[model samples]
Target: MSRPHVATIKEMAKFHTDSRYLEHLHKISQDGDNDDPQSGDFGLGYDCPVVEGIYDYATAVGGATLTAPQCLLDKRGEVAIDWSGGWHHPYHPVVGTGDLCGTGLGKGTSLWMTQGWVKVNLWMTQGWLGVDPMAGDPMCSFNMTPVRRAQCLQHALCHVLSCCVSVLSFHPVSLCWSY
Candidate 1:
């Protein structure tokens, strides 16, 4: 089947509060950058569009609810995967609106304001499977060779697929692994 159309910036803003934050995101999506690490406008590299796609997919699958845990419970047999997620940060509406010279200003400090919040736990609470083939290995270190890291991820993903087959018990499944 054809993939669903990705969401626009306007659609994503609906899931968030804080007009300032929304404006920052809109600028990143449109003008390409606003220079604040704590704001969504900071990152608009070539991969920004891809990141937007991932967010759109997650929201479309009903993963943005405030009560995601309860929602999962209500749909016991259904399965959803958000492979590109797991950044584990909260959405702060007023993050970049305060004093410009404040301590830790512009250093991505606001990014941590929502750490460990409910939204960050969506995957864990909703029964999403996490597989780390590099578990117990340091292949993810920046000093590690790119080839080594790629190999590790590939092995891990293969292992994940095998585990899914066994755990799924012959049930049909749909998976999206966005990067």
Candidate 2:
């Protein structure tokens, strides 16, 4: 029997922040460690709201569920999503630093998915956080992925990092795969 279609959604949440979500910001400051002016150590844990919100949106749009470590692939059609696939510097919540610092995890994963077969549309933030586009060794987002044949198209939208750069790219199901 043929395997069922699967999709993945991944987001590189920002670090050096006071709190995870805006709602808890005030609460975190109230009783937690506000020592660091840059980023307070609020000993509280909250769900990554953006990531959760994206999952909800994907489900509503007909995307399949995915595990944190699993990769979603579409050999037939298109997928939809809100944010994810940016692959910047991030702590694994516990382990070593995750794909952050602009290492091109998005491109890496895309290459793994298409196995070098499809094209990629890269959507990035603007201004201080904006990607040089013309810079970066790979240059092309699609080419950044493991899939050599993958082509990349840059989509530098307004207010990208302000929300989630992943949101700019409309791909249902966060693709997760082994590096």
Candidate 3:
């Protein structure tokens, strides 16, 4: 397994934010104070905390998530592993509505499922924050059982992190996102 190119701070910013957020992050990093009064306006100090070196952390995570798609786009591999997958949910996209998943045409990841996840189990493994029967509420997700829970969590992670693609057709041959 080779490492893909790490995305530049500029690139990550282009995809997710602009200069304002980056500037705020740098200011927080320098002062080591994440308790800015207007932090909520910047979407920080909420679910995402404003930590020291948050700029670096955010870039690293973005790079890691971009790795799988980069590898596929570069034709470096058919299967790319991105442990950072499944956590960052996009604002809006398609999935459950697509005919590919519900028509029993092919298996898919819950990454695209916005709602009604509890209804679909045949095409994909029960997955993500609320979809997995074992995984409970979004705020405090994951199971309570001991050994079996661990195994199940691991299984779900594997499904989340790995994306398999058919080189011939360029489709997701497995539970993964392909370029």
Candidate 4:
């Protein structure tokens, strides 16, 4: 598949204040190494590939948020999709130093989501139904037994699918699903 349009560091910095985290993220992008120790301690372990495309993912979402408003305003039927963009947990005014605490710094998925939600709400208020299929809460059962963990994931997936189907059944618009 073709790559989505990614946002630049300058564009992303507008939503954040910590220059240090942003610098580190920039380095990661330049180096293309998610396990870069210089990325501080918030690295997503050694086996996860989530960190590899984190910057691009964030950028894609940011791009979507930036243009979604205009798209909806110009033409009420415009459909914008950013499949890799939906972090949903990170917050703003990140509080940390050398190593980001909480949900880690530069993970502005939540920031993008917040902005996107506002635009989406605008669309919905204007009688448009925006279908965002971002299901399966990642923090289901991190400490459960192996078998139980699998069950929890399965259950979460089912719940997410059910919710998506229910929403689709009601509102028929652009469908964006993120697994």
TM-score of every prediction relative to native: 0.32, 0.23, 0.52, 0.42
The sequence of per-residue lDDT tens digits that candidate 3 reaches over residues 1-179 is 75646668677666555577667776787788867886687777555777778766666666765776667567775455555444343422234332343433244433343343345443223232222223232343444333454454454545433332211111121212220
lDDT string, candidate 1, 62-93, tens digits = 23332333334455323323333332233343
Candidate 1, overall lDDT?
Answer: 0.34
Q: What shift in Å separates residue 102 of candidate 2 from its native position after superposition?
A: 16
Residue 37 lDDT (model 3): 80
Clashing pairs in 1: none
Clashing residue pair totals per candidate (backbone < 3 A): 0, 22, 1, 0
Q: Against the correct fold, how does model 2 do in TM-score?
A: 0.23
Alpha-carbon local distance difference test for all models: 0.34, 0.27, 0.49, 0.41
- Candidate 3 or 1, higher lDDT: 3
Per-residue CA lDDT of candidate 4, range 3-115, in tens? 33466878777765566666766567667876576554544444333456566666776665555444445553334333323332344354221123333445432223234
Deviating ranges (above 4 Å) for candidate 3: 86-89, 92-138, 141-179
Range of the 10 consecutive residues with the lowest summed lDDT in candidate 4: 163-172
The candidate, 1 or 4, that scores higher on TM-score is 4
Question: Model 4: which residue pairs collide?
Answer: none
